[model samples]
Structures are given as C-alpha cells and as structure tokens.
Target: MTSLSGKNAIVTGGTRGIGLAIARGFLEAGATVTICGRKPENVQNALDALADYKDRLLGISAHVGKSEDLEKLISASEDRFGAINVLVNNAGTNPYYGPIVDSEDAAWDKTMEVNLRGPYQLSKLVARKMLSSGGGSIVNISSIAGLTASPLQGIYSVSKAGLIMLTKVMARELGRQGIRVNCICPGVIKTKLSEALWADPQAEKQAAAMKALGRVGTTDELIGAAVYFASDASSFTTGAVLTVDGGMVL
Candidate 1:
C-alpha cells in the first residue's frame, strides 16, 4: 500500500466528484489534505461531510484559473501544512459542449484557463516549494478526451490534450529536481462533470459497451492511481500518462 502518512496534499475542485473522492482516499491513507472549491458553501459542506478527518483536512474557496486565487491557495496551504508534498490539479471546466466552430470565445478561454493554464501555473508554484522541501509529486487529472476527441466536446478535448503535453513538458524539466509530474486520463467517469456521458441512456450505453469492464467507472476507481502518483510507490515514475478507462479507449 502507498503510505502518505507524513505527506501534505492539496486537491483543487475537491468539494465533489472525482476530486472529492481522491481527497477522501488520501485522508484514509493518512495524508493531510487541503481541498478547494469555488464556493465557500461547497467547501464548508465538504469539510462537514468529512468531519471524521477534520484534523487532517482543510477546506478553502478559490478559483484555480485565477492567478490571485491560486497564489492565495498556495500561501494558505503552505501556512497550514508547511511545505506541500503533493498537488493534484483536478480542477477543470467545460462551459460549452458543442462543435469546435460553435464554441464561443468565453467557453474556449474558460476551458483552457481552468483545465490547462491553471495546472501549469499551480505546478510552477508548487514545484518551487517541492524543490526546497527535497521532493514532491504533481498529479494532473486529465481526461481520455485528451487522447481521443470526444464528440461535441471539441474545445474541452483540445484543452485536455494541451494538459497532457503540459504534463510531459513539466515532468521532463522537473524530473531532475525530484518532482515527478504525471497525468491520468479517465474515461467516462460517472462524475457530475461527466453526467452527459451517463445521464443519457444512449450515451451511457455506448460508453459502457465500449469499456472492457462493461460499465462506466466510479470515482473510487481512480483513488489507487492518485495515491500511487502521490506516494513514494512511484518514485521512479515521471512524465508518464496513465489511462484508467477500463479499456474504453481500446
């Protein structure tokens, strides 16, 4: 088992869904976690729900896509947990779900800002702390859409693809400095953000039939990967992209 007993991790967009699941899993594995959501209410709700681990958890309200907010997030986490040992860039957005050409400037920019740019900026900030703290891990929650375009989610797919490249670029540069950067591509995960894939019977059936597991995956399925990437278990791994799609992409 990967142990994160002494590790301090920050998970963005962690008030619900995949990010929330990962946060709970990390806490279960003994890591101190800081979770963020855009709304203070959501953050408080998560904290209350996870009250069992309150001593090991912190909740904050911040927008990952905003530079000032990201700065404050890091500062607050640093103050609470000392130097962060793990950063899970799980915050993302898909404001528009339509054809590439039909995507407006606002949607395109929002998707890029949240899914790609935010992680890039946050990684830079955390990597500096990791360097001084001796070492750390950065786990990016990219989507399988990044590897293979999803119909009607053109701009979101494009943004995720950029994230995959960003993961590799940062990994190569930071690997020598003891910071391992990796990306995980999950397919048809049954999260609020991915409701479109499962809420519609036709889409859900297609997604389930395509997967070797014969079903869309639960958020819990991702915990293992998240934990491994954040722990010393993957000490020699860096710049790698893992697909946790239950063979859906095959």
Candidate 2:
C-alpha cells in the first residue's frame, strides 16, 4: 500500500463522485484528509459517511469557484491539519451542453469560472502555502475531452484544455520551490458528473466500445493514478498528464 501517514490533503468537491473516491483513497493510505463541497449539508453528510475515520477526516463547505470560499477552505484546512501536503483540484462544472455556435455567454462563463478559474485560483493559493511549509504535490483533475473534442461539450472541453496548460505553467514556475504539479485526464469514468454520458444503455455501450479496454472506467480504476501522483512513487513525474482513459485516445 502507498503510505501517506504523515501527509495532510485537501480535495475540493469531495462530497461525492471522483472527489469522494480520491478522499477515501487518501484516508486508506493513512493521510489526514480535508474534503470540501459547496453545500454545508453535503459536507456534513460526507463527514458522517466517513465517521469511521473521524480522527483523520475534516469536511468543509466551499465553492471552489468563489475566491472567498476558497480562502475559507484553505484557512480551515490549515487550522485543523497544520500544513497541507497534497492539494487536489478536482471540483468542476459543466452548465451547458450543446453546439458551440448555440452556446450562451452565461453558460460559457460559468463553465470557465468553475472548471478553469477555480482550479487556477486554488492552485495558486495552495502553492504559496506549500512553498512556506516546504513543498507538496498538486494534482489537477482534467478530462479526456480536453485533449479531444466532443460536439455537445465544447465549452467544457475548452476549459479542461486550459487546465492542462495551467498544470504545465504551475509546474514550470513551482519546480524551483519543490512543488510538483501534474494532471489526470480521465475518460468516461462512472461518476455522477458523467451520468449524462453513461446513464443510457446505448450511450454507455457506445462509450465502452470506443475504448480499447472495452469498458467504461470505474472510480476505483482512476484512484491508483491519483495515489501514484500524490505519493512519493511519482516524485520525478511533474508537469505530466497521466491518462486513465482505457486507451480511448488510441
């Protein structure tokens, strides 16, 4: 098992889906984890679910897209865990799904705000903190759509692509300080955020068929990549985008 017994981590949008899975993985590896979601109720619910690990878990409510919320999140995590060792920018939004030509301005702005701006801001805040307390790893959760386009998700795709570039920029700027930055581009993972693509039998089959592995990826399958990036296993792997897409790009 990858051990992170002395580590402290913060995972945004961690009330459910990929974020929740990542938090669970960190806890299993013995890291003290702080999870954040936009809703206080959801955060409480997540805390309740992970009650067995109460001593090592902290749940906070914050909207990553909002600067004030992000500030509060970082403050709360630092207060509870001392210093953050791993920061996962996993919170994202896709408010619009349609042709790029028909996409509304508000939809595009909202998508950019959450998917791109939020991560950028959070990474900046966390990186500064990490620099002062030695250094740490920052993992940005991107998507396969960022590398390739899907007609209905143009805005979302664009935002994710920007995230990939942001990861590189952070790595370049932070490497001197020992803060490694990287990204994960997962394909059609079975998460609530991706239910629109996988909930339908026909769509799910089509998505699976496109993959060389012949199946949509499970949450567990992507957890290893996250663990590898977070642990010392990938100490030399920075500014790299690890794809857990079942060879869909192939």
Best by lDDT: 1
Residue 159, model 2: lDDT of 98
| lDDT for each residue of candidate 1 in 22-101, tens digit (9 for 90 to 100) | 99999999999999989999999999989999999999999998899988998888898888999999998888988988
List clashing residue pairs in candidate 1.
none
The 0-to-1 C-alpha lDDT of every candidate, in the order given, reads: 0.92, 0.91
Query: How close to the true structure is residue 27 of candidate 1, measured as C-alpha lDDT?
Result: 98
C-alpha lDDT of residue 194 in model 1: 89
The whole-model C-alpha lDDT of candidate 1 against the native structure comes to: 0.92
The TM-score of predicted model 1 comes to 0.98
Q: Distance from true position, residue 143, model 1, in Å? A: 0.5
